[model samples]
Target: MVNATQVSFFTLSAYFDTGVFKYLYFIIIVSLYIVIICANLLLIVVICMNRSLHEPMYLFLVSLFVNELYGSTGLFPFLLVQILSDIHTVSAPFCFLQIYCVFAYAAIQFHNLSILSYDRYLAICYPLQYNTRMTSNKVSVLIALIWLFPFLAIAVLISLSVPLQLCGNIINTIYCDNYSIVKLACSDTRVNNIYGLIYTCLIVFGPLSLILYTYMKILKVCFSGSKQTRQKAVRTCTPHLASLINFSFGCLFQILQSRFDMSSVPMMLRNILSLYFLTCQPIFNPLMYGLQMSKIRSLCKSIIFGKTLTDA
Candidate 1:
């Protein structure tokens, strides 16, 4: 019965009364949030403070890690608050804000990964020319573009969504989702849908295409080159490839759960699946990169434990 303009808050029906179990949930989520923050921040610090880690690859990683922190912060605190509250309601403006944050986070992640792939492509395929192509200034600009493009793109999406006349105020999920809000609109949404499609092509498929192309090129180089070259490619590219695959799969899960009929599935499992990308990706990237990248692992050990192990 509520109009979109008049709707002050939206009900999130995903949450249920878990009684004392809420406390357990709260502890678990809070612990997760803390871990995400600390892990990402630790890597960021390790990258920034060490001059040895100031190369293009590590710089790109800093951007990626910072994004993990940004994306997780956008979701975890709000989720924590909602978990403890009896009524799961979020203000309209705040909901849209969350949508913006979440969307931008996703966009930035894809773009960042794309650029990282490009960096790898340069490093592996054209090692002699990498310094010339991926200069510090260029790296700075690429970093700027990754962050700027997503924030601006999501802003337009929010602007489009905010003016819609919604038929309902209830969001079925725990978090504010742009597609869900657009679906609630009683007003004409053709423009929104069109723009959304365009944004997806640009933000999602565009980067994915670039990533695929770069990897194929990298693979070609590895096959044609020496064993040392193959080892080098594997050493540098494995973590990035793993991170991309993991995040992409997580995104796929979220998309399937959101766009399709999942009512037959258990609600608890649905909630976990919905949150998988946001929760897992943040922690996943740091661990994958931290352990897999020898330089970072050695540097971390040196910083944490008073023993400076040489990079293997």
Candidate 2:
């Protein structure tokens, strides 16, 4: 039996022989990575350069855009290499690193969205006190915690998996996963399993609960307020809602595909579904927010065109 320390590499069993199509696959992935980097970078730059956008909402958006870059960078380059290589194997340490990046990315995304919902809640429900509540210092602290908590949590997770005595090292999926590694362990995994459940609740359910509560409060204010207030609520909340829903579905698809028996599903569809959250969400968020938010849209136009177009 190969133990964890003895295992030097893991073969990704999901990748098949694509023959000549491998080059085509490589080109498509490269294009996607370039787009993800450029779009997210543009948004981050736009938010940081404009003083009018130094408020809590745009600051949170900067964090969001930065994460899109972080998450995509972690996956895309590795994926591009794998697509072109005949042997789909990764070094053990690199595999663990990828797991850390993927898990931390997910945790940060949920926390960021939750913080955004709360920001919107304050802005719409208590416009008079929104500034007082979501001050610059507070926003900085929240963004810090948003990133710090996830890194620490996923650190603990990776630590638990790193020292295990592994019976096998072949991960059935295209990328390394903590649970997949845990399942390969020859040692006891009760603690790992238990901690994973707690981590899941903290990373997933906890933020979702906060998001739900904030939206409910926002909805109450919208119902009782004036037409102008209602319009404001709709205009501001629409992008956030769309982003939350889009990311939530992507996560849902990924989780279901990972945990459930997906053998009946076609290989191409399974591969696409597994990669949906990582690939699509990075691109989806910037486009969704960029076009829908008038301020961002106008600023992007000004930057790209050298003059602001009239807001229609």
**Candidate 1: minimum summed lDDT over ten consecutive residues — where?**
303-312
- Which pairs in model 2 have colliding backbones? none
Over the stretch 103-191, how does candidate 1's per-residue lDDT look in tens digits? Answer: 88889999999999999999999989989999989999999999998898899989999989988888889899988888888889999
TM value for model 2: 0.97
TM-scores, each model vs. reference: 0.97, 0.97
Stretches > 4 Å off in candidate 1: 307-312
TM-score of 1: 0.97
For model 1, the local distance difference test gives 0.91
Regions of model 2 farther than 4 Å from truth: 308-312
Cα lDDT, all candidates: 0.91, 0.90
**Superposed Cα deviation of residue 240, candidate 1 (Å):** 0.7
